[model samples]
Target: MDSLKDVTLRPWPAPKKEELSQEDLLVKIEQLASERGHLRDITEKSLQEDIDAGKHIPDDTNDAVKQEAKEKEAPSRQERLEKVFNAGKEMYGHLEWAKFAATNALDLLSLVLSQDTNKRNLSTFSQTFREQGLNQGIPFGSFGISKENHEFHNRKPEELQRIQELEHKQKVVAQGARMEALDSAVDEILQAAKQLEKEVRRQTKYWQEIVAVSDQGWPLQRLRQNARHVPFGVRYGLPEAGDHFKARGFAPLQMDKDGSIILDPALALKPKTFRVRVSIDGKITGTSQLEVEVDTKDHSIQKSIQLARDSLFEEELYHEMSLETRQLLAYGVEFRDSVISVDAPLMGSTSHDRKLLIDCIPREDIVADSHHHEHDWLARNVAEALRLLLAHEHSMRLYRRSQSPPPLTARTQEQAPPPLLRTLLAVFRHLEGVDSLYVCLEMVANTLNSAGLEVTLDTTRETSWAILAESLKEPSKRGLSATDQLLEIFRKPFDGRATLTLPTSNGVQFESLTIVTRTIIGQPTFGTEHKLTLPSSLTSDLHLFQQLKFSSVKEVTSYLDWILPLHIAHRLLKSEYSSRATIKSHDSGITISSRECKRGSAFSTDIKVELLEGKLKATALTASPLSETEHTEQSHTWNGGHSSTSFKQVIQNWVG
Candidate 1:
């Protein structure tokens, strides 16, 4: 940087004044100071001496500026007081004239605005002012002190009459102007009356329409701004909707030319509906119902509100599903080009695979996916379930807000969004998985019962739904109503269960097995799960320890097919034959060592029972030297056109 430019300092000299010594002001000040005894300077002495000697300085401090300032202070204050008094006199006179003028102006205005034309005029008003002695203190009018130079008395009669003529002409001109003003004021009054009458009619019509809208049961709210044509707004959206949708719910009910309410811009967008279609083998099987058709030209307030509300619901549903596609990448879910692709099979098998395609389309759009209506119920139920879940989410949003909020903190904890789509998926997965297993179990139990064995079977769709009536009989806690508590069901995991008892021990024994199906969308569980809990008697010798969990329905069924047969062969049959029947190898096999009726020989038969395809198969083999045919073996399968039979009968025929 260049050195800062040299700046020359300008000297401002003090003004010269005559010495005050000529007036003896300095001499008198010195005499007063001498009498008062000035403080002696101790600069030459040590600092200790200065401290020891207490000093006093005169009030003026022997400074010229201080003495001058002190002397000028008194005179300046006195002059200020005199100036204030004079100002008060002037202000008081002005105030009195202003008061009189205001009162007189008010009287004149009232006279001008009066219903009847006034007989008095401006000249009379001025004469009254002069009577009040206004001219003496204020500049009121042309009246003034008489002077000899003005010599009106010495003027000739002709000159005085001419002056009088001029004054009369001036009065005539002022009167004409006042008369014109009165005419203008009359015209204005007529115009104002017409406008007021029209305004009254318009206000009446607008209020009547507003009353109609309010009476329709739609909530009305006052608009703080934009009340020019529309003074109020309607709330049609769900209360616990997302913040953005919540804002879109309110719109000013602007009145149109016919005094009918028109839709606000926020509610005027093209209406759309959510479409959930079931596609099997690239063909549409079912679709959600479309909104009722509406006439565009005759769009009423109620219709518009309904359309906006439905559209908001569809949009939120689409948005939530879109958000879910990110977390469900492992489940073949994709959200591309604003379309959601997901699997929604009715059964847990690839043969019955179905794709659930979700999209939002204009309400008026047409789709004829009516070829196959078999899956239509499934699709419609899916759509309704999703809607119910969204509604449940809205209730939960309010419930969470009513509870005590977490303490304030700088570290932001992002609250998870409502699991509308996740819950829907869980519902589908859980129902399908549990129902499929239960159906197979019923088939197996029927086969065993038909073969002279008593097997008990029981199943429930949902535990909560099973005892819903009993639960509702009791009073609820908190401020939550029964409806809110009922809606709480969707927020938790869905549970389905089934129980079966072994055939050998009958219903009196504690040999039942429970298969519990649980489905949760997030956290530790990412899919449907099933757990088969066996009786402790059978699990003591097995790795199952009475409880085993499976992630899929197929796995749970396969494990049960292996465990149930093993349990029977080792626990039931071994105990029945007492030393004669021994478990050969472990899974689904046993041997009976007994003497034949005639030959008196020992023999062992191996039997294995299991599920094959959709059928049940029981195989038996006997190896003995007691009058038996070579390669003796018996096998039978049920559900594939074969006669149904139980494993116990096969075992008896082989070794007895």
Candidate 2:
């Protein structure tokens, strides 16, 4: 390691002769003594830090090791301070009678160290005991005085004086060694202080230049002007300008006249305000008023807001207006002009079954004749009537067990829904064209009214099944007869049943025969009511069949029918004669060969043959067959040529 180098140190706050007199210098010295103590503390802390950081090696505390360390450590401010004190004390003892060395030394040290500019010079110190040794230098063991043999404590007054003089001289020489460097350091400190002050001022000027440019970062002038048109939001300058201007050594002022806020450097600013604008796609749907206020009371910030209300609900209004207009336009467009698909058979079947799809709109001509209404009313009804007609056709198919019709176009967008009045007119026109159609409809209408049905329009599917069922409840003056007949007569195509009962003089007789059963096969509902209305018919025919109450006791499935008078006579005579007459055994098997028996035959000879199964079979010999046999007998007599003399033979020929 190199030994301590000769380092040049400068004084801080260089001292002036006028500024610090001897008395002031003494006070400064005392403060420097305290500063020395502070520096010593700092040095110790640095030494400890070095030791802890492994920068110092503590092997042993020998005198040689201590000396080596002291030399390695460069002089600090505390050491320089102490040197000044020691030099001043030496001079003070020579001048003053009293011992003012301590006071003087303190004064000189303060003056010197305070003026020092060198940081290295401000960090020095000395051992406390060594300086005391310099105050009293001669060794105590120098006189021949031993602790075991004390001789009047040895005369040492002159020896003490000699010791003090030598010590004082040594102290003086030590203080004089650094005197020239101290003087040079004072001048150096003064020069450096001037330069530092200049640097601080230059930096301040540089910052101010940078802040001036940054203050208008967002064009506050434009922001203020634009804010006037917005109706909302306050405009203010940037909040950071004050801090920035201060850093640059300039005071910034608020630009309140332009509505641009600026933080004042002179006064504490609570907070700054600024303007903002919100827009979408450049369309001005709304304008708002907004205020940003910073309360100086508690530095609280709040924004007040107000927005213009939209008075026109345009979206909903437009949609409603368009829908209504479109509906009206649709009325002019021709609809139902297209047949789509027609199933006449299905419609006919519905008539036969006496069921109409009341929900469906009737054909156009029929609708017009029925109502004679305005076109608009007719249009609405027509749509409904058509739907009902289609539905009736479909229901009839189900009733007759027929194959479903081909799919018709359900969506007729071009057609405005035909009105109810139109359908009624169309139906009336249709009825007028076909007599049978009128009769069918009248009967149905009558039957429906009589059945107490309640008619109501169904709007769901444009077709109404409701009217049919409901209309049936209306009263029918002719009862259900006309409807019953019409439904059955037209039902030939649908295979329906019919029953007829007629009154005889003796009894009431009836017959049920189905001309066509094909139609009713799938139409179970329509045929259900066809069940012999014998009860209803009989009830109506009470006066006509009142005499049948006394007829034969035999139970008859059809009470409406009884045997005729002629038929009854034939039945009685055959029964009586069969019991009394002889049983003529025929050539073949019990054949009645006598012709006299059949003369104006009031009775029928019914020969009943009973098989083993007890099932009786009957054959009747007619009066004409008996007469023919008699004629054959006469012809044989004539052929024999002896019949002229035989009276019996002649009689036989005449009888034949």
TM-score per prediction, in order, is 0.69, 0.19
Best by lDDT: 1
lDDT of each: 0.74, 0.31
Clashing pairs in 1: none
Considering summed lDDT, which 10 consecutive residues are worst modelled in model 2? 303-312
What would the TM-score be for candidate 2 when compared with the true structure?
Answer: 0.19
- Candidate 2: stretches off by over 4 Å: 1-342, 346-384, 387-499, 507-621, 625-656
Per residue, candidate 2 scores C-alpha lDDT tens digits across 1-656 of: 12333456765665465466669888866765564433334566776886799755543544577789889997899999999998788557556634356555543454345343452231231233225532357332222322453334555889989999999999988788678678788878987897777656654543343244345332212234334322122223222222332133222333333333333332232221111111223221221112333342442111110000000111112222223333332222112322111111113233331111111111111222232222233233433333343333323434434445446787753523222222232233222223222233233223222322111211111012223344345523333333333332222322222222222222334322111112121133221111223333333422233222211111221221122111112322223333433444321112232344445543223232211111112223433454544322111111112222332222223333
Model 2 C-alpha lDDT versus the unseen true structure: 0.31
What does the lDDT come to for candidate 1?
0.74
